[model samples]
Target: MNGKETYDKLKEMAFGEGIDLFRIADADCFLDSEYEGNRPQDFLEDVRSVIIIGSVVPNGVVDPLPKGRSQYTNTLMAATALLRVASFKLARFIERTGHWASIVPNEGSEFGYWYADKDTLRADLSVKWAAYCAGMGNYGINQLLITPEYGPRVRLTAILTDMVLDYDGKSMPLISDACGDCRRCIQVCPVQAIHEDGTFERFKCKEYMFSELGGLRCGLCLKVCPPGSGNP
Candidate 1:
């Protein structure tokens, strides 16, 4: 089957399970060259297309502490579960078509520096950015992918396949500057990690996550994001 037909079939599968699939040509997609090198052969072997999926976290699930566990961590875990299912389904579909499909996680590849070298790491595109590039959504000021339906409250997962697929090329207006005059996310940051310019200080956020007492994590940014606040 051609790229467009393969993509259509995959879309139907996703819809059957109530998941959304967005497609973009693997070659045309731009990733962080620093983490993901320009050498396509290194990370992806004959990757014809990339399938991006978004999972919306349910509202009212954000809590600093619930009983003894952190609610934010629970939500992330839930999102991870959703991604796993979707990716596996897509992989199987692609394999059935006689093409190799691999579900690569956002984290570094399985192979050490040799197969998935550090350069590939630098070139690795941010999950949110990849989703946006795939025409799945737009970029939010907090560096999160904001879907029209889910806002910045979604987790992204991807599937790489040799199966050719129709490209969406639909670029959404970036909202990276949406914080324009508003700094709600910054003002509400418990660790004060969010900068006035809407840029996040990763070190500050990481420290907060690593040093939090009782091991409870915080998703202040995710919680404060107004998009997924209401049910769709």
Candidate 2:
């Protein structure tokens, strides 16, 4: 199949499998000087497409927040697990079609945290930025991709492949102008890691989740997000 044909087939398969969002981005999107994360090309030889596939973490799972962190964390992991299976199957299909495919770590992946830079606490690449580049959403002040449909409660996995596909460039600002003056996430953050200026203290967040919380994922920022919280 050609690029468009492959793109359509993959997208259909993803949605048919209950994945909520599916968008492909040209691997060169990472080459933009503004993107600071690891480049897709470095991860795979001649990587031509970054297939971003994800599903929204159910609002039911997010409502408890910092109160039930264990439940929240487990649900997030469950979501991640589902993505892994789907992406694995998709990758296998791609390879069967004569292209190489690989899956990147998503939320709740210890591999991502383990391989991350110690000082920066950043993974090999920013999956949120990859999602944004794919035109799936804009970044919120909390630094999570805020899709118009799901807001910040989305879980994403990236698939690197040599299949060239039709995709869009970044059409919105790096950060959404729509979240103006909204401090819900900052106010909800226990560690005060999020700042008004849109930057966050990754170490503080990491320490809070892994150290203070005993490895439970903090969903305060996600829980308080306006668009997806059903409170706005």
Candidate 3:
């Protein structure tokens, strides 16, 4: 099947399984790795499209907890489960149709087949960013993708495939700035990691995550987010 047909089939399968899948050409930011030498070509030789999937974590699943317990972990696990199943099904479908496909987990030593560079030490840009680039949702001030219906409460996964897919390029530009100059997330940040320029201090965020603050990996920014403020 052609790109569009392939994308349609994937989308149908994803939605059928309660997941949202967005299709974009490999040119999207997620697929481009020129800045970090993490290009997609290093992995799948015939990669023609990326299937970005997003699962909204219900607000109820985001309870703030002490250091040892993480609601983020729980939400991520839930999202991962959905993505894994959907990805497996999609991969099988593609293989049955005579194309190569694979499901790349968000966490791993390599991005598909590309090995990490020693000096850079950068994992693929956050999967959320990939979903954003695929036109799945808007990027919130908290550096999270905020969907119109789910706000900043979502997890993302990606599937790499050789199947060419039609590009929607239908991004929600109007959903820009759900934060809206509001520094609630910044204000709530105990470490003041969020800067006025919209940049975050990675070191500071990391410190809080590992510190004895007795919080679940510092999800204050996420918990305070009014959007998607329910159980996952």
Candidate with best TM-score: 2
Off by over 4 Å in 3: 20-22, 28-37, 63-72, 107-121, 170-175, 211-215, 226-232
lDDT of 1 by residue, 46-112 (tens): 8766678766666666533333235656666676677778789989988987888877564211111
Q: Which candidate comes out best when scored by lDDT?
A: 2
| Candidate 3 lDDT for residue 175 | 38
Better of 1 and 3 by TM-score: 1
Expressed as tens digits, the lDDT of each residue in 1-232 for candidate 2 is: 8788988999898888888889988888888888886776775769888899987787766786657777778888888888998899899999998889988877673224655789777787777777888898898888878877777778888898888888866788888765787788888888999998878888888888889888888878877775445422
| lDDT pick, better of 2 and 3 | 2
* TM-scores for all predictions: 0.77, 0.92, 0.75
Give per-residue lDDT, candidate 2, residue 145.
80
The 10-residue segment with the lowest total lDDT in model 1: 107-116
lDDT score for candidate 1 against the true structure: 0.59
Error of 2 at 82 (Å): 0.6
Query: Residues 92-184, candidate 3, lDDT per residue (tens digit)?
Result: 998899888866565311121123233443444345555555667776666666666666656666777777677656456523566665767
Per-model RMSD to reference: 5.0, 2.3, 4.6
